[model samples]
Target: MGSRITSPEDAAARTAPPMRSQITAPVAKMALSSRIVGRGDASFDGAVNIRVETSGLTTPPIVTGKVPAVGSMITEGKALLEITGRPVIGLAGVLPMYRTLTPGSKGPDVLQLEQTLDRLGLDPGTVDDEYDTDTSRAVERLYEKAGYDAPEPDGRLTQAVDAAKAQVDTARNRLRQARAQLDAAKDANVRDTSVQQGAVDDAEENLVDAQEADGEAKFKASTPLPVSEIAYVKTLPRRVDEVKVERGGTVDGVVMSASGASLVVTLKVDAQTAQRLKAGMAATLDLGEGTPIAAKVRRITKNGNQYDVVVAPNRLTPSQLALLRDANVRVTIPVRSTSGKVLAVPVAALSSGSDGGSRVEVLRNGEADLVPVIVGLSADGFAQVAPKGNAELSEGEQVVVGR
Candidate 1:
């Protein structure tokens, strides 16, 4: 039978422990003795208690083979408590495990492997960073090159799984060699002096030329051709001639605004080339004829090729306009013309020397004497040389490019 509560206090007493319940306690003292050893400095500590608890009620002592000698009583006590509650107990030494896998001993990275395979002339097809059939084929070829008994480059790699280990060593060596070359090129001071010097000079010259030509070409290409107003006149005797412009009548599109009938030759030249050319510059116009017509450049347009320049006849008259119309002409644009005595060499006979200078392998005393010459302006495949005392070099002298 359950007891019924008459008051709230009675209900609380029934729900919890009864307040009237009391007991007498024992007064005997017990001491605990503990020693922390097996470390650098041995230590001891004792604690006393006045409880009448049973001997079996004490917590089990923690035993350890080695304890690091650190902080005094505070740290030692905390470490002891933690070590007892640990789920695992073992020695302080590391476990013996073979370090077979290193920083790079895993399977090859697909991207780099694909690049290397391509470099070795083995097409891995796609560089998608996947170890697909193509990658396996490339690996097999690599193994074969490494002197391993691997299967063909068809992705059948099961039989040579162990032998394929050799491929890693071979590929690593190749990677080292490539890295060495890159390092050497990067460190200018350590690079081959002759090669670096020549490469730097040539690169600088090429870059300057490319930039100049690019800017000139863009500026010239964008400028519109010049338009001019013309007054057309019918031909008559000079004293009785009259010039007139009709309201709608047009002469067959006079290409040139200059007087008289002559052809206009529009030539495109870079700023550098234009510096050498000017109005009244004599040029030979070859209108696909075996013989060329001698013409004087009568006008120089502000924009070369983007605008046309009228070339007047130094000889012919209006009779030549029929010959000039619709005629495709190739003008002989001369860079330079030299006739006076100058130390000259045939262009074909010139070759770059090992010491980074231009040379002409001239036949001297029946033996090839490679003469390093500083060449000047070249015209028609003949370059003028300076320090001119090479009287031995003549117009028809044979020079060699190589022995």
Candidate 2:
């Protein structure tokens, strides 16, 4: 038996329309008889096929009906709503802050300045850029001495800028003087072979002397050796006899026809990056089998392609030395570490974008924020990202890895 309706009046009447029927429009009816040739029943699919055939399907209409609404509700015949939020979209980059170099910067700042100046071919006295009397005097003296045209005052070599300008002038003058000497020697009497030869030889010698002096000065100015190394080598000359007791103890200080083959691995680095891997630097050599051979940079060779860094073990056991001689041992050159924290970032997430710069996407609030970053020293797969102004960053921030 069918369930009974509670209302007595309702039981007599027919079932009312559904509540949803008031809000929903009636769906257009599809008649099966239309395909079978029935009257008053239109066929949209047939119409579409006919239109497509007539148009050749190559050129379609640019404009069409509006896309279906995503979310809509009716209050009366019409309703109104406001879009209250919007998403901001752009790429972000990470950049570094340019360091300020001025007087009164102490400790690391001074040391950095000193190192930088040293790298730039200027000595900032004792590898310490403090504005002491000695440093000021040395700098001023260097600037003045760097040129001959610049006046060399006996007492006060204090101002750096003036000294630098003076030094350049002096160098120019010396070069001019050397050129004049060479020219005068060329015009000397050639008929008197003996005298002329002697004069020419003298001029040539003078020029060579001046050039050697200049070259030596330039080298000294440009390449300041490490203080510790300099101190270490003070006791020994360029040639030192190594008495390896384990290699059978310096018998007669004789060369026993010692023949050993050194394995050479060549890695390429840019000119700027090559400066850090200078000769005599203590670098670690990773020989396979979980063992590392402590090595010193033997020499840096310049070829057409890139720097060929020759590394020799500072201390090698007989077995390890034999392995090194084998020439098939895989070696990894680890770049030396700096004293303290340098600005650094992940290597993968950086991209060189359209502006011809490295860029990284910073994730803020789950969205990509692009920032242009200045970079420095990249090693161990991590690069140093410089800070810009006061807007520094901390570790573990969500940096966008990719699109």
Candidate 3:
């Protein structure tokens, strides 16, 4: 700012205005304070919709039994519905049944089915890859008990079983030949024993492979879940949310809706607000004008300008679970904030000093002095600030909010 001074006395008098009386105004002060002022909808917690698809041999079969009611809780090994007049029981596994499991089946799908069968009280051989005689027998028993015809071993499956068995035999023979040769070499004045040793080493590897192949064969005589008894689900003991199939209805696609034991509430917010929410952050769940319960942010998935937030309750009783299932609820996730009381001032009190730094004018003894301060987290109407260096500032002291 350019100023013209007619004389030294005039310059001094004009540049420095007379000090005014102390401006007693509202103080930017604080007391033990905490604020959870964020607003979000409060509804009952919702459930996760798990698609219930059949896994038995038939692509689409008629539902022969009564479908589980919408509110029924189906535990592990419990039947969801009858398909093809055979009950497809729920089993806990990550892999869904993809193909028919007959004799000679060899894959993780088969392995999982085998394990499930064993767990279900139906012995599927050694519970390995091979659907051996034991696995075939188990499948037959399961179907027989269910009053349905068991799965029969197809020609191709039988051939596969035979081939695997033959390989094992071949491996065993080769090992025997190598061992005999090694013995002969040992008894004789064998030069270049390395060849004998190498043969023995090769035989050992062959025998191991043979043993694995031999165990992998699903035999016609084994009792396995004839591709009709197994049902794959992400988790066990899921509650049935809806039943799309009934007696005589097509059980081809998702015949029911289910979910895990826990229920959660999902909400979306703009990215800016999403930034304030974090996974595992504590939250307050409001169920209408009802009592509030504690919750935690279960997950936060970001998508462009939007964010999906999932919150799970800390605990829920059986009654609460039934009440809140699929119920819309408001979840309040407190933004990351300054936890406790701190020296603070009204943001309006802060002014840019001549040095371009933050400072507040302190009004005391009918005079004002600039006190430099470092600003911190702001919440509600207070901005956390600390006096910098020797700049005198005290807790509960009045600071000039404005002129």
Write model 3 residue lDDT over 232-316, tens digit each, in one string. Answer: 7767777777777679877555667777656777778878777776788888777665578788888888866787787788987
lDDT of 2 by residue, 70-115 (tens): 2211111111111111100010111111232223334554454354
Q: Name the regions of candidate 1 deviating beyond 4 angstroms.
A: 1-263, 304-310, 317-319, 340-343, 352-357, 386-392
- lDDT by residue for model 1 over 267-355, one digit each (tens)? 45445455555677666665554456676655555673443333444554444444554455566545454555566655676778787
Residue 64 shift from truth in candidate 2, angstroms: 99
Where's the lowest-lDDT run of ten residues in candidate 3? 32-41
lDDT of 3 at 98: 62
Q: Candidate 1: minimum summed lDDT over ten consecutive residues — where?
A: 35-44
What does candidate 1 score on TM?
A: 0.32
Top model number, lDDT: 3
TM-scores of the candidates in the order shown = 0.32, 0.30, 0.66
Overall local distance difference test of candidate 2: 0.39
Worst 10 residues of 2 by lDDT: 43-52
| C-alpha lDDT score of every prediction, in listed order | 0.40, 0.39, 0.70
